[model samples]
Target: MSEHGFWSRFLLPGGLWLFLLFVVPICLVLALSFGYTDDLGRAVYAFRLDNYADAFDPLYIPVLLRSIGYALATAAICLLLGYPIAYYIARYGGRHKHLLIAMLVIPFFVNYLVRTYAWVALLADEGLLNSLLGDVGISEIQFVNTPYAVIGGLVYGYLVFMILPIYASLERMDGSLIEACQ
Candidate 1:
C-alpha cells in the first residue's frame, strides 16, 4: 500500500472505536439532558432548557460555586505539594531516580477504591488516627464529611498525576540554565 493508505488503515480502527464508544454515548447523553420524564416516569427526549434552568437555579448556585472552589483548592494543593517533590526527585535522585519514581507510582497499583477506603480507615472518628490520639490523651477529632477531607482526598488522588509530568519536564530541563538564571 502507499504510505498514506498504510497510515489510514492504522487510524481506521481507532477512529471507529472513538466514534462508537466515546462520541455516540456523549451525543446520547447530551440529547437526553434536554429532556424530561413523563407521567409514567419514562424519559422523554425533547429540545427543552428546563433541566439546565433547574441546574442553574438560585438554590443550586452555591453548590456549583463550592464545587468550583473545591476543584481549585485541590489543584493548588497538588501543585504546591507535587512540584517540590518532583523537583527533588529530578534534581537529587541521580542513581535512585527510577526507584524514586517507582515508589511514587507504586500506590497507584492498588485499586483507587481500596486506597480511598484506607483513607477512611485512618480518618474516621473511630479510626486509627483517632485511636492513636486517644492513647495520647486527646479527644477524637472529626475528619470525615468536611471540606478539608474532600480536598485532601482530591489532592491524594491527583498528586501523582501532577508529579509525573512535572518530573518529566524538569528532567528534560538544563539545571545549569536554571542556576545561571538564579
Candidate 2:
C-alpha cells in the first residue's frame, strides 16, 4: 500500500476520532466560558472577558497557587513511586507480569466512589487497619479527615495513571542497554 493510502486508511480515522471526542468538547467549553448565565441558569452566549478577569481576582489567587502546588506535589509523588514499580514489573516480572497487571487494573473495574469510600473505611479510626493495630496493643491513631489521609487517597487514585505510561516505556526499552550495565 502507498504511504498516503495507509495514513488515510488508518491514521485519519484515529485522528478524526480524537478530534471528535476531545477537540469538539474542549472547543464547546472554551466558547461557553465566555458566556453568561441567566437567572434560570440557562447559558447566554456572548463575547466577554469578565470571566477571565474574575479568574485572576485576588480572592482566587491563593486558591490557584494552592492548586498548582498540590498538582506539582502529586505529580512528583506519582513519578517517584510509580517509576520503580513499573521498571521492576517490566524487568523482573516475567511469567507473572499478566497477573501483576491484572491486580493493578482490577480496582478500576469498581465504581470510583465505592473505591474512595473503601479507602475511608480502611483509614477510619475504627477501621480495619486501626482495629488490627489495636489488637496488638498499639494505641489508635486517627487517619481519617487528615492531610495524610487526603494525600494518601489522591495518590492511590492517581497512581495507576502514572504507572501505565512508565510501564509502557520500560516494557518497550531495549533489554541490551540494561544488560550492558551489568
Candidate 3:
C-alpha cells in the first residue's frame, strides 16, 4: 500500500466509532425533535416545528437564559481561579511542577459521583460543615439547593479541565515575553 493508504487505514476504527457513537445519536435526536405526541400520548414522528417553538416560548425563555447565565458564571469562575493557580505552577513550581499538577489531578481519580456526594455531605444543612458551625453557636446555613451550590459544583467539576490547558499554554510561552511585559 501507498503511505497515504496506510495512514488512512489507521483512521478507520476511530472514524467508525465516531459515526456509530456520536453522529448517529445526534442525528437520531435531531430527527426526534421534530416529532410530536399523538392522542394516546405516544410519540409520533412528524415534520413539525412545535417543539422548537415551545423551547423558545416566553415562559421557557427565562429558564434557557438562566441556564446560559449559570454556564457563563461557571466559566468565569473557573478562569478567574484556574489562571492564577496555573500561572503559579507554570512559573514558580520549579522541579515540583509535576507533583503539584498531580495533586490537582488526584481528586479526579475518585469517581465523579462520589466527589459530588462528598460535596453534598459537607454542604447539607445537617451535614459536617453545618454541624461544625452549629458547634460554634451559629445557626445552620442552608448551602444545598441553591444557585450558588450549582455553580460551585460546576466550577469544582470543570476547574481542572480549565487549569490544564492554561498551564500548557503558559509552559510553552517564552519567559522573556512575560518579563518584558512586566
Candidate 4:
C-alpha cells in the first residue's frame, strides 16, 4: 500500500458524513442552548446564556439534579450491564446468537407507542404486576406511575440504545481476543 493509499481516501467519506450530520447537529444544539423562545413563542437566536442561567433557578434545579443523577447511574449501569452481556454472547451464546439478537430487535420493530402502552398495561394499578403480587401475597411492592416505574420503562426503552452496537461489536470480534482475555 502506498503512503497516499486507500485509507486516506476512505477518511474523506466518513469525515463528510460527520461534518454534515453529526457536527452540524451538535453545532445547532450549542447555538440553540444560548437561544430561547421570545414573548411570541418564536425561537430567538442570540449568544446570551439564559438557557443555562434558567437551569440554576430554584424550581428547575431539583429536577436537574434528579435527571443528572439518574443519567449518571443509567450510564454506569449500562456499562456494567452491557459489558457482561456482550462478553457472554461473544463467549458462550453459541448457535442461538441470531435468535437472541432477533428477539431484541423484534421489540424495536414493534410500534414504539405500542410497547410503551404495553408497559402501561403491565404497570397499571389493576395490571399484571399487581395481580402477580396478589397471587404471591407480596402486597406491598409499589409500582405504577412512580419513580421506579419510570426508571423501569426508561431502562427497557433504552436497552436498545446500548444493545445493537454491542451485538455488532461482539458479532465481529476476533476469536483471538477472547482467547487472550481468558
Candidate 5:
C-alpha cells in the first residue's frame, strides 16, 4: 500500500486514539508533575520544580525502585512461562485454537481484584494447597498476604494477557520456521 493510503487508514485512527487518550494524559501528568497543589488539593496554575524534587526524596525513591524491580521481575517471569504455552497452543493445538484462546479469556470476564482474591483464597492456609498437602503429611503452608502469594496471584491472573499476545504472534508465525529451527 502507498504511504499516504496506509497513514490515512491505519495511522490516522491509531494516531487519533493515542492523541486523545495516551498522549494527552501523559502530557497532563508531565505538566502536573511540575506544579503544586493548593489547599483544596487541586493543582494550581503556578509552575515549580518541587514536585519533581520531592519525587526523588529518599522516603519515596526506595519504594519507587522496588516497584520498578518487581515490574521487571514480573515481565521476565511472564515471558519465560508464557512462551511455551503460547507456542503450544498456536502450533500444535490446531483447529481448536480459537476455542482454547477463548477459554483462557473467560477468566478476564471476572473482575481483576476478584480473580486475584480467588487465588488468594485457593492458596491460603487450610485452603486448597493445605488441604492437598495434608494428604501427604505436610501441613500448614502459609500463602495469602505474602509476597509469594502476591506474585503467584499476579502471574496466574495476568497469564492470559501475556499468553494472548504471544499466542497471536505464534499463530501468525509461518510454520516453516519450526522446521528451520528444528
Candidate 6:
C-alpha cells in the first residue's frame, strides 16, 4: 500500500475510533468529576474539587486499604492460576486450541446470577460437596456462609477475567521457541 493508502485505511480510522470510543467518554467523565450532584442525585456541572477532597477522607481509609488488599490478593491468585492454564492452551492446545478457548469463554454467555446460585447450591450445608463427603463416611463440612466461601466464590467468579488476558498474551507470543524448549 502507498503512504496515503496506509494512513487513510488504517491509522486515521484507528485514531478516529480511539478518539470517539475512548478519549471522548473519558474527557466527559473528567469534566463531570468537578461537578456536583443535585438533591435528587442528578449531576450538576460546576467547577469544584470538594468531591475529590472528600474521596480522601480519613473515614474511608480503612475501606480503601481493604479494597487495595483484596485487589492485590485477587491479582496474586489469578496470576498463579491463570498463567499455567494459558501457557498450556497456547503452547500445546494444537488442533483443539479453539475448542479450549471456546470452553473457557462459554461461561461468560451464561447468566451471572445463575452461576452464583449454582455455587451457593454446591456450597450449601446439604449441598453436593457435603453430601459426597457424607457418603464416604467423612463428616459434613460447612462450606457456605463463611470467609472461605466468599473467597472461593470470588476466585471462581473472576477466574475467566484473569485467564482471558493471559491466554491472549500467550497466544500472541512467538511460538517457534516453544518446540525448541520442548
Instruction: Give candidate 2 regions above 4 Å deviation.
Output: 1-16, 133-140
Candidates in order, TM-scores: namely 0.90, 0.84, 0.89, 0.75, 0.79, 0.72
Clashes in model 3: which pairs?
none
The global Cα lDDT (0 to 1) of model 6 is 0.86
Predictions ranked by lDDT, top down?
3, 1, 2, 6, 5, 4
- Comparison by TM-score, 1 against 5, better one: 1
RMSD (Cα, Å) for all candidates, in order, is: 1.8, 2.6, 2.0, 3.8, 3.5, 3.7
Query: What's the TM for model 6?
Result: 0.72
Task: Report lDDT (Cα) of residue 178, candidate 6.
Answer: 68
Kindly report the root-mean-square deviation of model 4 from the true structure over all alpha carbons: 3.8
lDDT of 6 by residue, 1-182 (tens): 78898678678878999999999999889989999899999989899999889889999888788767777777778789988999898889999999998998888798888988999999889999999999999998898877567667777778888888988988998877767899
Q: Which has the higher lDDT value, candidate number 1 or candidate number 4?
A: 1
Q: Give per-residue CA lDDT, model 5, range 1-182, as digits (tens).
A: 88898678877888899899999999888888787888999987557888778889999999898778767777778888999989889888879888888888987888988877777678878688889998899968887877666666667767788999999888888889878999
State in Å the error of residue 166, model 5.
1.8
- Per residue, candidate 1 scores C-alpha lDDT tens digits across 1-182 of 79999899999999999999999999999999999999999989999999999999999999999999999999999999999999999999999999999998999999999999999999999999999999999999999888999999999999999999999999999989999999
Per-residue error (Å), model 1, residue 66: 1.1
Q: How accurate is candidate 5 locally (lDDT)?
A: 0.83
lDDT of model 5 at position 32: 81
Q: Model 1: how far is 54 from its true place, Å?
A: 0.8
Q: Rank the candidates by TM-score, best first.
A: 1, 3, 2, 5, 4, 6
**In terms of lDDT, which candidate is stronger, 4 or 6?**
6
TM-score of 1: 0.90
Report the C-alpha lDDT of model 2 over 1-182, residue by residue, as the tens digit: 88899779888889999999999999989999999899999988899999999999999999898778777778889899999989889999999988888889999999889999999899888899999999999999999987667777788889999998899999999999889999
| Candidate that would win on TM-score | 1
- Candidate 1 local Cα displacement, residue 182, angstroms: 2.9
Collision pairs in model 4: none
